[model samples]
Target: MPRFAGKTHTAGHIFFYEEMVVIGAIFGTIFSVFYPFFQFYKWIGNSPVWETVYIILGQLFLCLYGFFAGIFVGCLALAIAEMLNSIPIFARRTKFRHGIGVVILFMALGKSVGSFIYFLKQLFVCGGM
Candidate 1:
């Protein structure tokens, strides 16, 4: 809903911005508060107190980092999407910006897919720690 850098944002940009902020907050909360949940991936067989402390710290750090990351993500995602759509600057058109957007989109998609796969691996993998 905020104006960014003198440019009026489209609806998609606003949506992504909101999404990133929500995601960052959620992840931050999850990481900081439930850090020990990660132990499910690999129980270090260490003291429970230490694990609890680490989980709290991790969540705190994650929440703060996520807050910051959300702001950047909103801006960058919009910029990338716009460039991909070929909204040009300068009288002389450069093809580079347009192509760069495509690359960014694919990279984002790939990472997202990879992250989902990794999450499943951690979730459904057999055997005990």
Candidate 2:
């Protein structure tokens, strides 16, 4: 959260940012706890109109969720990398003196490819896709 605020140059509003983060966490927790109880799919399944609306809205929600989730993960990964100074350390260890940019690019691409595979294979679920 601090990383997000810092990246946006909104460090001065740290309190507001912290409050928003807390509120989001609370809402997320509540949603997770009550999600099965809601059974939205069961309720909407009978109505063609409602089902179409739900599908469209759900896709839009997922797109937005994915966008923010990507931002958070990217920020987290970069923050950890920067904190450890891993890139420079690795470069020095390998006697590499140039193309740090190339290394960073490959690292990012690797992360993207790995994440894509994880989701494509549905590895998050209990059973394999």
Candidate 3:
């Protein structure tokens, strides 16, 4: 028997890819973006000695120049995840869609640089670094 369901506007197949993209984003955001911060908070909430460690890490890891650095990372994570979600749809349409990924990568790079600069400023001013 021939494979009846492949492409050409099949609702179920399209939905599957869309769902795949969304799920990938959710997983990526949770694992890459939030896990470290959550672990830090849990650490701080539990121990006294670790509180010092937490603050130091917060200064070094979570802040830049002197401001909260987590926001930039989180935003970049979200942007990358969304771009990944777009991949499934774009891949099916045109070879040029590959270029979309490059664009997304540049966006992510921009986010990273901006976040790093912002945090570096915080590190200097707030003594977080």
Candidate 4:
């Protein structure tokens, strides 16, 4: 079992990581499937006294969520790249001799800029969300 960080680790640690990922996927699937049945949104909207507090807390929660979500996505991408040996193959195909780090940095920058434009422009809202 390969670790996401490319570090040498014991089998137990690898199993633990796999278990956590599976558990997260299972819970996420369940939540999405039953989202309509969850009344937290309604409760929040109905509570006038706690509305401000809820909004502040909700924003904080979203910030934390976004931070961890970014980490998870970055780690997942790295793991996939390692698994497929994509960098080496890409370099060979392009006859590139060096500056792989620069290529990766540019890719990340592109993604960041695209994401900023997408959310700043509320493109997702136009998708019927």
Top candidate (TM-score): 2
Compared with the true structure, the alpha-carbon lDDT of candidate 4 equals: 0.78
Ranking by TM-score: 2, 4, 1, 3
Residue pair clashes in candidate 1: 28-63, 31-59, 32-59, 32-60
Where is model 2 more than 4 Å wrong at Cα? Answer: 1-4, 41-45, 86-129
Off by over 4 Å in 4: 5-11, 43-45, 83-129
Instruction: Give the C-alpha lDDT of model 3.
Output: 0.66
Which is better, 2 or 4, measured by lDDT? 2
- Each prediction's TM-score against the native? 0.32, 0.58, 0.28, 0.53
The number of the candidate with the highest lDDT is 2
Writing each residue's lDDT as its tens digit, candidate 3 over 33-112 gives 56676665665476767787777977785446335346446656766677688876776676664467687778779989
Is candidate 2 or 3 superior in TM-score?
A: 2
lDDT for 79 in candidate 2 is: 83
Off by over 4 Å in 3: 1-83, 87-95, 123-129
Candidate 2: which pairs clash?
none
Write down the lDDT that model 1 would get. 0.70
- Alpha-carbon RMSD to native, per candidate: 11.9, 6.0, 13.4, 6.1
lDDT of 1 at 62: 95
